[model samples]
Target: MTERELIKKAQAGHNSALNQLLLDNYSILKGYLIKLTLQKELAEDLTQETLLKAVTKIQDYEPRGKFSTWLIVIGKNLYFDYLRKNKNLRNYEEYDSVEKNRVGNQEASAEDHVISGLTFEKMRETLGTLSREKRSVFILKHYYGYSYKEIAEIEQCPIGTIRSRLHNSIEDIRRVMEEEGLDGF
Candidate 1:
């Protein structure tokens, strides 16, 4: 069924349609949260909160934007709210979450595992340096390929603010890479 049809059914209280819509967007939401939080467990927890909010508020959903975008805005708000309430997690020092998911598949060579692990480390390090707002804008725009207008809508900020945040985020990542002499990445 088309997205609109699914949404119509979902909004009308069709459990299957609601499940389908949430399932379809689960990975997108989780993947974005992983990058944003750099903590697998916290991302998973926030994703659950986001989906729950979506389900309870499904009736309030409008078709003005993609459903996935709406889910992200909810996810982002929950994340920020979580941050405000939990000061310690905001430090981004929670390696326990990443370590749990670091195990290689049984078939992968040790060499492949090592290379990928290093890449993940660098990425997490780079992304961890930015403020949450800039990180959200950067991830939505460059990582998720959303237009600035869509990002503004998802973030409920002015387009100019989104542009500025993205610009600063890119610069922040660039500065970190150069300063660390990790330029080749």
Candidate 2:
């Protein structure tokens, strides 16, 4: 069935349809959250909360946009709330795990692995320095390939504001990369 059909059934109070809809968008939402929060565990927790919110609010869902986008909007709000609640609780285990996984999957030489690890480290550090809004804009646009207009809608801001945030984020990342001598990346 089409997504619209599933949504209609879900809105009509069919639990199975709702479960199907949520299942379909689960990975997209979780992956987006993981990238946004840079914490796999937190992302998983937020993903569950986001879906729970979606269940309660499914009646209010409009089919004008993708369901994944709506989930992301909800997830983003929750992540912002989390940041407000825990301002100093940064964790790097997620990044470490990501690097380890990459190394495990790659068949490249040790020197290549070292260079890749350094590049990933520098980029992560640069991202860490970005403001939450700027990082969100950057990740949504570049990492998730969301259009500027889509990002504006998800962020609940004017398109111009999204553009400004994205432009500034790129500049911030570029400046950091240059400073770290990883500009080629």
Candidate 3:
């Protein structure tokens, strides 16, 4: 069935239709959540929450765009809500332990191994320093391969704002990498 039909059925109280809609768009939603949160468990939890919220608010959904877009908006809001509650405090010890394990498991023969580690660390630090809005645009555009137009729609901002954010983010990353002496990487 078409998305509109599925949405109609879902709004009409068809549980199966709603489930199908969620199932069909699950990966997209999960990917967006993961990119936003950078934590698998948190992303999964937010995905479920987003789906539930979408279902509850399904009746208010207008057929203006793809249903998946609406679902993603819900997920994005939930992700921000999680961030607000968590207040950017992460377990640095756990993060370092995981990084150490990952580094040890890497092959010695890997290309650019010497610079790769520094580059990645620098990039992570730089990304963390970016404002939430700029980081969101960068991740959605580069990591998730979202178009500027789609990002604007998802972010509820103008396309020009998305473009500007992405541009500024790339420049910031470049400057940070240069300062860290890993620009060649």
Candidate that scores best on TM-score: 1
Shift of residue 93 alpha carbon in model 1, Å: 22
All candidates: TM-score = 0.80, 0.78, 0.70
RMSD vs true structure, all candidates: 10.7, 10.2, 10.9
| lDDT score at residue 70, model 1, on the 0-100 scale | 95
Specify the poorest-scoring 10-residue window by lDDT in model 3. 95-104
Where does model 1 exceed 4 Å of error?
88-120
User: Compared with the true structure, what per-residue lDDT tens digits does model 1 show for residues 94-167?
Assistant: 21122111222332243233223335567578778887777787778766889878998987767767766766
Candidate 2 C-alpha lDDT tens digits along 1-185: 89999999999999999999999999989988877777899999999999999999999999888888999999998987787687743542221122111112232232233234346657566767877777787778766778878987898877667766666566676666557666264
Q: Can you write out model 3's per-residue Cα lDDT over 1-185, one digit (the tens) per residue?
A: 99889999999999999999989989988977765666789889999999889988989999887777888888877777776687763542231122111122232223133324345556556666666677677767665667767887887877666666666566666666667666364
Rank all candidate structures by their lDDT, best first, as comma-separated numbers.
1, 2, 3
Instruction: Give the alpha-carbon lDDT of every model.
Output: 0.77, 0.75, 0.70
